[model samples]
Target chain A: MRVLAFLDGTLADPDAAHIRVDDLGLLRGDGVFETILVADKNPRELRPHLDRLARSAAMLELPAPDLEGFERAARKVIDSWIGGRELALKLVYTRGIDGDPAGVPTAFAMGLEIDEKVQRARTEGVAAVLLERGFGPDVAERAPWLLLGAKTVSYAVNMAALREAGRRGAQDVIFTAADGSVLEGPTSTVVVAKGRTLYTPPSTIGILPGTTQYALFRGAEKAGWTIKVEPIPAAELTTADAVILASSVRLVTRVHTLDGVALPDSAALHRELVAAYESEY
Target chain B: MRVLAFLDGTLADPDAAHIRVDDLGLLRGDGVFETILVADKNPRELRPHLDRLARSAAMLELPAPDLEGFERAARKVIDSWIGGRELALKLVYTRGIDGDPAGVPTAFAMGLEIDEKVQRARTEGVAAVLLERGFGPDVAERAPWLLLGAKTVSYAVNMAALREAGRRGAQDVIFTAADGSVLEGPTSTVVVAKGRTLYTPPSTIGILPGTTQYALFRGAEKAGWTIKVEPIPAAELTTADAVILASSVRLVTRVHTLDGVALPDSAALHRELVAAYESEY
Candidate 1:
């Protein structure tokens, strides 16, 4: 197990690195974060992740993240990478410690080894359960304070839903809104393919605008694949030619089964997405 | 600002203490926590808080917290308190660092000084805005994975709601359901008075059963005041004789106005409730 964290994932000791006990990120999960895939000792799609981080911070009313500083830190970690061939670099920007007169925001870059199980899912695919995310797009639209579009760390419910999935003998979870619209995976974007067109939920539906999904779509556009951002009803998933999950770390994971029912196979489409993510990078 | 944290708040350095970078508590906000009021160098209503912590942990499917250990730690912190006359002791139990073979759970007890501003709200009262919590009781009833009734550290939404309150020029917020039912405050419980009875949203509505509210009600019952746990429609708040918020730290906070409109004053009832909390302790 290799561990390192710092301004650039450099000097901080993995065993000793710690944030303030009073840090809002620790106490209140009051923060935003991004996980970027570092391939070839370089951060891929760096700018997009930073942009999303800034957007997330803005949504939380947090001071704009120091993106330039984060960029430097992320690059340093990648340059000195010691873990694996591909690294999952995480950047966390928190609302600082409690009662600080300075109001300094706490930010750090850390590297994590992609879990073997998560990586294996990219090829072997995964079984998932559909769980209620509790709100529809309409509610999210009217309730900005819910911070649905932002990738804040308040993910207890997401984790719980995943646990519930596991209890049902599934490995992953796809969240659905009350209106019966397919939302997103616990930590990934949900994408469905039928024919040459790939469909995903729009940002208006309060799903995180996935960085990897965007990259794939941009790449697929040139590869003659049509992309559509629309509301996908829960029933649509069952009939879709392929159901896939995309994230920064796990680039392309096909959902083989949902609620114990087999989904249509799309190994060819899945491989294309993986290639697209890599080729675009 | 005074600080101390340890098995008994005796040894750990406040400035140096920190959790790992990938702590699930920090990474995923996957944890349960309780904030208890400490008076006279003792943790008040300690057992109730511990019980809630266990319940919350069970809901998250984390390992049951070692309640006996937590009790001893709480006592230690209280024994060596060096803060104000009253302290807000927070107990946090997290589902350890990621990928640990042992799957060790992280637990800590920290003592924080009662903020002067929060203390003032107890008497001066607070103004609040009603914000959409985005889901109704029915959704929560069906979705245990939502973790609605548990007080997990995943408080990003709660903190965001408070910021929204500040933006609306209010000091606090009352979260309402999609069905227009009054839910709870960002960090407190909702209690409204009408004549001799106090009505709060029932536990069925998925609100954290408030410890302070419970103590107050128990005391109120002895004082010949009736308490009812029921759904409060948004409109009912306007006609209520008194609106109040209760929490472990900020006990007996009168909500004098809702959405900038004045709620009927019930100073005598407010005073009585305050006395109830104090007398019960």
Candidate 2:
């Protein structure tokens, strides 16, 4: 399989590749991680994404990855591209090899071929559901053993929610804490257009801070729109004029339904965010 | 750099090992693990330890390890022993490699050597202190995002706590929640003897269920000692005759202090549990 490898800002092959049974990330969902999308040979929103990765690593006390090195390697991978096809590049750093000093972490990066369908889905809109079987917000907040905000490698439950949504015939899932507060989609940031204002959850409330969503908001302001960061109740989600899931590759895709309820037209908001993200480049 | 290697229950030379970093365990902390003492070339309390491993895997919906094969491989490693001395063995299994499947997991296994110094420290007793850092317990019961009860590989935090304890000049650290409920140590189980009954925190409280402690409790009961599984407060620990940290290799070691406060002798309980572990097989 094709993969991008790097360390300290140089592109290379992974020195060692294969998961040991002892790795904490996969075994206990015991880690956090961040994924940045590389568009048409350029990593979108590099600074904000790396900044979030550092913040998450610090929260978990995991040693910070070599961000500068990572950026160089990522660029190398993008530069190696001979075509202008939009690519999905992911940088994953796990608490490294077992039996080593716990401080230094194992890191790797690779490019994936994301389906072109996601870009089309953004305008056409995708179906979604509110995941009901989710952990409580306080548990997500206070459990030291819980890797809440940090995107450590432990992501079983998160992936499970996606599968459950798929089995029910939805393209993605939005989660609400036990207390009924709307969180985010499995791998995307949640955004809703209320009038002309763009709203997203604050990361401090245990959501992965989305670099793409932040950029969209910045572009939104320039496009003459207001932005709001607030705790949204799950009940309020279905009433949004347009609901969207934002990630690097997907940009912003509108949610056409919540559970089984058909959402009202959100094509205009979707178009606005797409144009905003693209124009910023 | 001595290490042990086990695969599908067969002992292999460490250099002959093979694993893929993409294995679910390494990628997602998507597996369970156990550490057991190799006493007189036998895995102490084998049945219960294997049972616990199966239970933990079940909790994560991963396939159980091949216990019968595991037994053969473990014995093979024991037979290859160049020295006839006792040692500690760690067994780790992960879901094997995959192309980032959403939910399905793969599995693999490996063995490693535990420090001989840990065994030596048991005879002299170790100084331990309680960290004011709270490890909230209620969340384990309520939070679906938590794998608190399982001894999964996502143990970076546990190791971090131990490193932090060492930095503070303490041999070990115990965690207490904000409300003052005592939790387990970073690598071992915490047990305090009060009057006649022996007490240890329940695994349902988000700490690992200790194999050594479980075996020792059975040994204690067989020897007519009263045992209890409940929450112990920090205040109660300071008042105890002895506080012991139990694990496979250490067996049962006495705690001499709690956050710098000296404690009375714990030789009796330590001796009792050590004999109990030794008498097995």
Candidate 3:
């Protein structure tokens, strides 16, 4: 229950501090953010992590943060934590404090709490359900009024999708457009092993460009695995050799089942991806 | 620049109050909100506005506010404000603060400042540009996320799209998916007059189900004008007899051009939509 927020460069107690109602992060979910894993006293993929944060900010048109200062702050936060155990560190930058009430927000940043259950699930893979693409089909057919490739803070639907999956006794949800194209997990990128070739939907399909997945793909390639970034339909999920969700802290966790069907072993791919990320980070 | 926040059944200064960071509105954009025109000391479409607010909240699974109570609070806020004249009123209700950091936010509301230029544009109209579909065209089309029909607070991209349009020297932006399906405007519903019929992209295409647009469509129907909700294209925008951005405050402002291509008799459609909204709301 102890949660802290990294407000710009300063850490504040989220429970006691008050955020203004006009903060764009609260008003319009108008901003970009990143969630990096804090493992063994170090933030994994420091440079690429900052790079992705900048990209998300640019895609959303928010002002960029001082990356050098931010990195130092992040490390400071990690170093100051009394518990040296593994933790999920989230850095969210909103469009700022005030502007045209209806206009794009200016910029703000703060850390958020990560669910302990998610950490447990990372170590022990869980089941997921295929939710009917709530956003509808053609969502990824082209660039949206805003690109979906950015990790903007406006993620209400993303969390809702996962909640729906939980109601169905699944740990997570994988979105499928109305046309049956598999997009990505609610909070993670997906990878499916098809024979010797690993396939994932390209970022062009409106999925957040997954940094962890990219690292995993690079690792898979170095291990002599054929990798393809193409649209995969929901129906083909069960037929793959294995299915795994890739993210910063989780590294990669095998999906035991999608819906009611059991999944094949994905330990090998998960192991490879984790090793790749750990080695590089 | 004074703004009031409507929380539960009370009003507070948005700048003076403190909000929790764990509010679902901030963490996930998991809420719905509305901004109405407070003209001549009265709130426009007050009843329908609440209905839309309730519907949007339902879509996000947030608890609904006390409708009658909310109205009382709204009236109180308006009464205390500079009466008459023109002012913008925003009603935002996030799930009351909750989740792991706290729990799942139940619901909350707040008000915001209105742009003077928006009201002026009603008579002057404004220039518009046809940009690629508003954010998440692919996700909306293929993955089927929330059908941009809900007025959920996750509108970071919508605001960004408008800014992008402004950057292009247009007052507003019309989103067209890469596949060439014309969507809605950034903050307004797009209505095109083609011959004797009116056509607008369907809300099913992930466009925010605009309250003002709904009223206008209803008014147009009563005025012996046929209305169609169908997929429009960028090419059709150039050919349309007129195009208007429809919203609560603006009612309808004709778009003089799309990407620099001129359209004719803009004010005629503007008046039509305005009349429709006023009569219906």
In angstroms, give how far residue B24 of model 2 lies from its true place.
Answer: 2.9
Q: What local distance difference test score does each model get?
A: 0.86, 0.70, 0.72
Supply fnat for every model shown: 0.85, 0.34, 0.76
Query: What digit string (tens of lDDT, one per residue) describes model 3 on residues A1-281?
Result: 33353535566675663667777787788777777877777777767778988888887766666687667667656766665366666666677676744544433233334567777776678899887653333554444555577887788878777767777888888877656788888789988888778888888767887888888888778877888989898888897888888888777877887896788777675666567556555
TM-score of each: 0.97, 0.82, 0.86
DockQ of each: 0.82, 0.27, 0.47
Alpha-carbon RMSD of each model: 1.5, 4.3, 3.9
Runs in model 3 deviating more than 4 A are A1-8, A100-116, A131-145, A176-182, A194-201, A217-236, A267-281, B96-109, B134-145, B177-182, B194-206, B217-236, B272-281
Candidate 2: tens digits of C-alpha lDDT, residues A219-265: 88899989999878888888887788988778878898889889887
Ranking by DockQ: 1, 3, 2
Which whole-number lDDT from 0 to 100 does residue B57 have in model 1? 96
How many angstroms is residue B214 displaced in model 3 relative to the true structure, after the best TM-score fit?
Answer: 3.6
lDDT per residue for candidate 3 within B106-194, as digits (tens), equals 43343445667876778888888877753344455443345356787888777877887788888888877657787787678888898
Two-way TM-score contest, 1 vs 3, winner: 1
Model 1, runs deviating above 4 Å: A8-10, B8-10
